[model samples]
Target: MARPIWTGVLSFGLVSIPVGLYTATSAHTLRFHQLQRGTSDRIRNRRVNERTGEEVELDDIVKGFDAGDAYVLVEPDELDEIAPGRSKALEINGFVDLDAIDPIFFDRTYYLGPKSKDYAKVYALLERALAKSNRAGVATFVMRGREYLVALKSEEGILTLHTLHWADEIRDPREEVPDLPGSRVSAGAKEMRMAEQLIDTLAMDWDPEEFHDTYRDKVADLIKAKQAGETVEKAEPAAEATNVIDLTEALRASVERARAKGKQSKGKQSKGEQSKGEERKQRTGEQSRQGKGGKQGRTGRRQGRKESGLSELTKAELYERASAAGIPGRSGMKRDELIKALEQAGRQAA
Candidate 1:
């Protein structure tokens, strides 16, 4: 069962609602243990007293700030005692338009749910009211002995809290960044138009499900290949930096490429829809002959796979096939090269 990281009362004006803060996101990163190079021993870290050069227990440690001439030490109990609202109340100071806050200020996210069924109505009221007002409640509360500036907003019929970076925590980019292309730098109107056209051609609705951590998958593949005494396929090298002198030409070519990709995607989508319609018709007619229909369906799927051409597939799909076929230098192959290599491999297998 999942548990709330913190249980507290959300306060605004005179109304207070008991809420629990649950983590909204999790990472699926692969972890590895550190080990000695020549032995099977695992490498582990330990806390040690700097002055005594001896191992120390966590309970004996205290937070210290280095002053000009001395160290000021503090205990965990002192932090909790000084925490705002006794670290049990989330007091919202005021509400502001959601767009008013810059995205850079946002940090971690947490779902705020009613602690009990009795407070559900009040929680729903706050969520709906915030959604209608299109505003976020700005607030601050202490967690893990540190105070956090947060924004409370309604998302998908529920309240979500986002911890924010304090004002002074944001670095000044102008001072830190070197050779920045500021407002003084400008692109030609023709180049700008081509760039905009490229963006329009490649524009897509945000669907996170369509994307994944390919690098992590490759890492897992690498480990499995090592276990089997085989090699893993590598990806292509990144493109070189665009030349400033050929900016217009680059933009024009990019627009053309994006348009071609968009056309290919639309064509595939249309074909998929047509296939689904045909399947529905077949199922409707084969209702009386289920056994015969099952055999025909399997044969039809095999024939469909055999009939599909390399040209209909995307570059990424072609690359995957080349990788599986173990084609030499597959990583560096262009789209046309990948298709040719895969076709030859298929002919050889046949």
Candidate 2:
């Protein structure tokens, strides 16, 4: 079992319960050691006195603050002595609606659990009350000789505390961001509609499992490739910025591309499908065919193409035909719906 980093009493109004704080998150970043070039020797860091040119022990070090022309030195024990509640208590000042706290203020999170089973009921009561009321307890606590502003809230039947940054700590984006667009600037009506359509077409439920740290995975692959004396494929260069003149065209193309990608993703989710490489090849062929008077070519093909073979074409390919035919709500349709809609449109055209 994981050990709690801090154990203390959490009090609110007249009620108090002993609690333990446990770290809630961890990073899986790869660690690298410093090494000399063309050598097996490792490089290490040391604490050395800058003026004396000699190494110093950690025990000899004291906290120092530069005040104008001199230094104010203080011992570690002195800092502990002055901390509120001597770093043993977390007192809730008040409760506020959970939505009242801005997301930017939230920092790290910690799981807060009852220290003893005897205090479980009190902990449960507080957690359930906060969840029911959609409120969070605002509190301050001292830990590791430092004070922290935190919010206590119930999450999935347990209490979780999140450290918050002070108001002064948050930087103003207006001052930090350079040459940001102002509210006065407006996009063209056509461009705005196309961009909004693209967003709607690409909308999906939030699933963290579907996302990952691709950079970290690439680093791991690089290490394995180097160990086996193999080279890894390089990533493609980033796309250039769109010109102002091409904004509307870019937005329209983006909407179509997003719709195509959404259909492709849906195809992948089905079982016993073609390999990704084969799927890409087929898509490339379809795109190439469409690029050369695609809408005109689809019209000629639709007249001769068998209706039953419509199922053979991927959802993305069917969507292209639907787009060329100007079928309504085609972007939101499934593969079967696209086939049915396309068949009806083809018959009408005939």
Best by TM-score: 1
How well does candidate 1 match the true structure in TM-score terms? 0.80
lDDT of 1 by residue, 58-132 (tens): 999899989979999999888887864748999999999999999999999999999999998889999999999
Q: Give the distance in Å from residue 284's predicted Cα in candidate 2 to where it truly belongs.
A: 35
Candidate 1, which segments miss by more than 4 Å at Cα? 84-86, 276-350
Candidate 2, residue 321: the lDDT equals: 60
Worst 10 residues of 2 by lDDT: 271-280
Give the distance in Å from residue 243's predicted Cα in candidate 1 to where it truly belongs.
0.6
- Which candidate should be chosen as best, given lDDT against the real structure? 2
Quote the lDDT for 148 in model 2. Answer: 92
| lDDT of model 2, residue 285 | 52
lDDT (C-alpha) at residue 37 in model 2 = 96
Please provide, for model 2 over 26-51, each residue's C-alpha lDDT reduced to its tens digit, 9 standing for 90 to 100: 88788999899999899999999999
Model 2 Cα shift for residue 136 (angstroms): 0.7
